[model samples]
Target: MFLRTVTTAATLLAMGVTASLAQDPIEERQQIMKDNGQAMRVLVPMARGQADYDAEAALAAFVSIRDDAARFGELFPEGTETGGDTRAKPEIWTDREGFDAAVAAFVEDAEAAVAAAPADLDAFRPVFGAMAENCGDCHEVYQVPEN
Candidate 1:
């Protein structure tokens, strides 16, 4: 009886995970959008801080932003759920060509943003803000956070 109960519990857990994965792709995208936003929140402050001039801090923030952005792109094509967590806006799917262009633009902007980070810790106001703007444009149209 105990063995049966444990097996049932495990099966139920597996089903639950599958069910969650089947949830609207938009929901997953929303979560990713939120995560990206959170990461951005952490990064900008560190860069903007007076102490950000330190070599270590700037490098860390750049790496963090780049890594997070790369993870965000995972939801688009490379993910198991290509259709899942992809509140990429209906237009993106329908206007495939234009959408691809936008995504390319984002990648370029993000890469440039990270590259622009100075080795000696300089004022990254312009580049970082541009990076955020690139992300923001997509989120504005494609991502919606759940209430």
Candidate 2:
């Protein structure tokens, strides 16, 4: 009986740990965006001529954004629109087709940037600008203002 009780306790503990690790969609997407923001930090200074452009670093940043964009859409599941301090606007669900298109554009632009593999600041600007525009467009329509 003691052995069986210990086994049950261990199983319950394991389940609790699993539940905690499984972040809600809002938290997951926020983390992904935070990661993308970090990647942008790596690229922005180089684009601005404040930091030396490194092909490897630029490629890695582009790849990160591409990867995030690929998975970002799944985080907006039906019930997640209004929780966990989400900045997502209702348009994200109401205008689902448009939202999906924006995500696709971001992914496409990031993939193109990665494929281009910009070797210098001159080469990096256009690709980065295009990807940045996609971000701006989506945020303008789909995100709530901080103020």
Looking at candidate 2, the ten consecutive residues that score lowest on lDDT are: 10-19
lDDT by residue for model 2 over 9-74, one digit each (tens)?
Answer: 644554464346357878778777776777788888988888988887788678767877887898
Q: CA lDDT of each candidate?
A: 0.55, 0.83
lDDT of 1: 0.55
Q: Which stretch of 10 consecutive residues in model 1 shows the poorest summed lDDT?
A: 73-82
lDDT by residue for model 1 (12-45), tens = 5544543475454445445544545555655667
Whole-model lDDT for model 2 versus the true structure?
0.83
Error of 1 at 72 (Å): 4.6
**How does each model score on TM-score?**
0.55, 0.83
Strongest candidate by TM-score: 2
Q: List the candidate 1 regions with Cα displacement exceeding 4 Å.
A: 1-35, 46-55, 68-74, 77-87, 119-122
